[model samples]
Target: MKKTINAPKAPAAVGPYVHAVEANGLIFTSGQIGLIPETGELQNGIEAQTHQVFKNLQAVLEAAGSDLDHAVKTSVFIDDINDFAKVNEIYAEYFTGDTPARSCVEVAKLPKGALVEIEVIAVKKEA
Candidate 1:
């Protein structure tokens, strides 16, 4: 009925939350930041950080037996609205073909002063 998704390839949750949770045919993921899973190091800048965020998201999705291509919705949080364009560029690299519906907004700050964070929802398709 329900399942928890965990991935050693993604950063551990900062709080008491699963990286992703699946119920029925859908998976809901927690917000992912730019922290590298191996070292827990935050990435350098907007470009690098955004890339890392997507990587983290991908890992969680994979753990849930889903992927970005299966995403139906996503929410992106940015520390600076100015970085919107750059983040979009990096984000598009992953979600370009049949991009999931998304909502991106600027926030005053994020946990650990990270530049960007993303949360996603995906559906597992039957073969």
Candidate 2:
């Protein structure tokens, strides 16, 4: 059985999609932009947005009974490839242990004009 996740601590979905879903021991998350949960506003700049993206991912992962440490893969999308270095620096701060496999690409745009968006695949923590 698959379980859907809707994280209250993360920003609400801007579209008709849930935050994540769990099936077969794996949790797959929807892409998360830097929309602030409390305010529903996009964070400013690449750096701030990158950090906020991680915060949103953390909330969704936690809601799915996992954390960054258990992540198996990640996909990052950025509005500009030039911001890769800044985004990588912030990304490093979050996945410091047993980092997951990742792919990043520059997209022409994202929902709500976000600077960055991230989604994850992780194993549920052992209970």
Candidate 3:
């Protein structure tokens, strides 16, 4: 069975999709941008946006009963490839242990022209 995940502490979805979905002990997160949950504001700059993206991803993971440590893979999208190093620095602050495999690429654009976006796949911890 599959269950949709939504976090009240995270920004609402811009489209129809939920924050994440869980099925077969795995959580698949939708791409998260830098939107703030409280005001629905997009944070400014690559550094701030990257931090916010991870915060959004963390909320979705928590909603799905998973976390950064449980992540098996992730995909990061950035408006500029030049911001990769900065994003990496922020990413490391979150995925500090047993880091998940990841792919990051420069995209033509992002929703709201966000500087960075991230989506993750994580396994539920064994009971």
Candidate 4:
């Protein structure tokens, strides 16, 4: 069975799902938006939102005993596909090495009208 994972530094989930779940040696994170944990507010724009998304993902991964370096795959959802280049810039900042496989798409809407949302799958590094 899978075990749910939560990050105290990340925004609390507004839905039923936990921030992530670990099964075996892999962790699957639920889509994370730009909501700030302390303020519970969405970031101002795409750039800020993208950065917040990564930070949130990082926190969850850390809680799951993993990090971006171990990420095997990721999915990015944005309200405007045109923002891909801008978001990609921010994303590249996090996954600096051999980047994980990723899929990005434009969505009509997101929770709390977030500009972006991201989800990741990563391997738990040997402790």
Give, for candidate 4, the lowest lDDT window spanning 10 residues: 88-97
Residue pairs with colliding backbones in model 3 are none
lDDT of 2 by residue, 31-121 (tens): 9999999999999999999999999999999999999999999999999999999999999999897899999999998999998999999
| TM-score per candidate | 0.96, 0.98, 0.96, 0.98
Q: Candidate 4: lDDT of 80? A: 96
* Candidate 2 global Cα RMSD: 0.6
How should the candidates be ordered by TM-score, best one leading?
Answer: 2, 4, 3, 1
Q: What lDDT, from 0 to 1, does candidate 3 have?
A: 0.90
Ranking by lDDT: 2, 4, 1, 3
Q: Please identify which of the two predictions, 3 or 4, would achieve the higher TM-score against the true structure.
A: 4
- Provide the lowest-lDDT 10-residue window in model 2: 89-98
RMSD of each: 1.0, 0.6, 0.9, 0.7
Q: Write the per-residue lDDT of candidate 1 for residues 1-127, one digit (tens) a residue.
A: 9999888789998888999989999999999999988888899999999999999998999888888999999999999999999999888899878889999999988998899999999997566
Give the total clashing residue pairs for model 3.
0
Model 4 CA lDDT for position 69: 96
Error of 1 at 38 (Å): 0.8
TM-score of 1: 0.96
**CA displacement after TM-score superposition, residue 59 of candidate 3 (Å):** 1.1
TM-score of 3: 0.96
Candidate 1: which stretches are off by over 4 Å? Answer: none
Question: For candidate 4, lDDT tens digit of each residue in 56-87?
Answer: 99899999999999999999999999999999
